[model samples]
Target: MKGDLSTLVFTGCETSGCEMSRSRQYDIKRFCFQTWYYDATEGRCSQFWFGGCGGNENKFATQEMCETICVEPPGRGRCYLPRVDGPLRCDQLQPRYYYDYTKKHCVAFWWRGCLGNANNFNSFEECSVFCKDVGPFDEPTTTTVPPPAPQNIQQFAPTPEAQQIDIVSAEQPQQQPQ
Candidate 1:
């Protein structure tokens, strides 16, 4: 209802809608739904609960829609970039994984969920695969250790005679009629 049809088409990466903060109606009659929004500061899409009434153009039905509308595709050397925890204004602790160029491996970090960099990943495996070629020159070796054998609990069990004695003691004799 505001911009022309050209505004609907994504011609460039920059979108003011992406930069807008998420909003939700605070009224008692508010109806909330989960939605995705492009976090321009973090350069990624994130989920947020939206109140059905008042929201901005930043809201999207899915992560894909948000990305297609606002996020720029990953470029070369993305893995080499430093990890970002995003802005402190949002203060949502999200556990994330990122490739550590110095360590030559993926490590865990707490993402503030608003404005981090593309180096952030949802899992260690995701980070490893994405930046596999960017790390150490030599492939890291891993040693697999078999799990310990199950203990023999039979030794702790009571013998048949002991069990029988306990059962007999536990039984009460029939009471005579008064």
Candidate 2:
């Protein structure tokens, strides 16, 4: 793309007088946040790739913000209700896989805390028991074949032909020793 002057944030030549007069000079502050929401349909915290410009009120500035909105409410029913595992960490939970009701398969999600519910499972195998039946997790395999070697191509050459005989001496004169 061609360089656009209108999109330039700083020209490095702005006078102090211009800076003082302008209310907002080169507002190039870019803000990016990982926004998450409790996907009741998926039974996990679904994330969105937000380009921080204009957004809706449901949008949050942090993962905590999303949790406050979607998780804190009583009977929010956003998360999974897995079997009660003792001392489930409500805080400092790690990301793990859970079964998505809508997708009918296992998916990755950041667990917020240890809460006893079938929607929550320690692993995909655990979740699969209560949810839809999914096949065992298998690593993807790849096979590569090397390219063929270059061959020496043979070229054709011209063959020699018979030479023509000169007949001028036979008709003129048989001058032997002049």
Candidate 3:
């Protein structure tokens, strides 16, 4: 663990002038993979990556593959979701590849890209709903994360190579809003 703990920290959401508050464990809001907001900086995606999977093993749910269709294609968002159902959601989202909220994980494939994420959300169901309503993925920031000193897993920052989320930005014929 060599980087700033604040980098991975997430703040709650403020919407419609309503301040939404949640305990560290359960907060209803959205978070981008990058610590700094890119859309705020510019559409330029400056995310750096060594590797990431959003726990989704299926090919169709890949945000990168689906970018061609989704209006706001999910970028590296899947990696953080942790709970998915089917093939990665790609250019043309197949229903079978759709996320199943009840499974607490993806259904047909190694991942569903559906169930709410444990890494980011409160419950498996919450993670699923969040992913289904909002795109589930994140872009890796370029900052280097030195290898863990091996003292504490809780203190360890994920390897920089392990930070990149696999996803794309594009519109598809069948993809729905994230």
How many clashes does each candidate structure show, in the order listed? Answer: 1, 11, 45
Predicted candidate 2 versus true structure: per-residue lDDT over 43-142, tens digit per residue: 3344665556654344444665444434332221322222222232233334455444345455555454454223455666655554443334332142
**Residues 1-178, model 3: lDDT tens digits:** 3433222211111110001111122122343122111111121112222122331111122333222111122332332222222223212221222233333333322222332222233333443455554443332233222222222112123455887644432334477799
Per-model TM-score, in order, reads 0.37, 0.25, 0.15
Whole-model lDDT, model 2: 0.37
List candidate 2 stretches off by more than 4 Å. Answer: 1-90, 114-117, 133-178
Off by over 4 Å in 1: 1-73, 137-178
How many residue pairs in model 3 have overlapping backbones?
Answer: 45
lDDT of 1 by residue, 12-125 (tens): 223446557765653434567788876655667889877777677778888876665554334424454456666546544567876666677776776666765567788767
In model 1, the Cα lDDT at residue 9 comes to 26
lDDT of 3 at 50: 16
RMSD values, in order shown = 17.0, 30.5, 22.0
On the 0 to 100 scale, the lDDT of residue 159 in model 3 is 54
Which ten contiguous residues of candidate 3 have the minimum total lDDT?
Answer: 10-19
Q: Rate the local accuracy (lDDT) of all candidates.
A: 0.58, 0.37, 0.26
Q: lDDT winner among the candidates?
A: 1
Q: Between candidates 1 and 2, which one is better according to lDDT?
A: 1
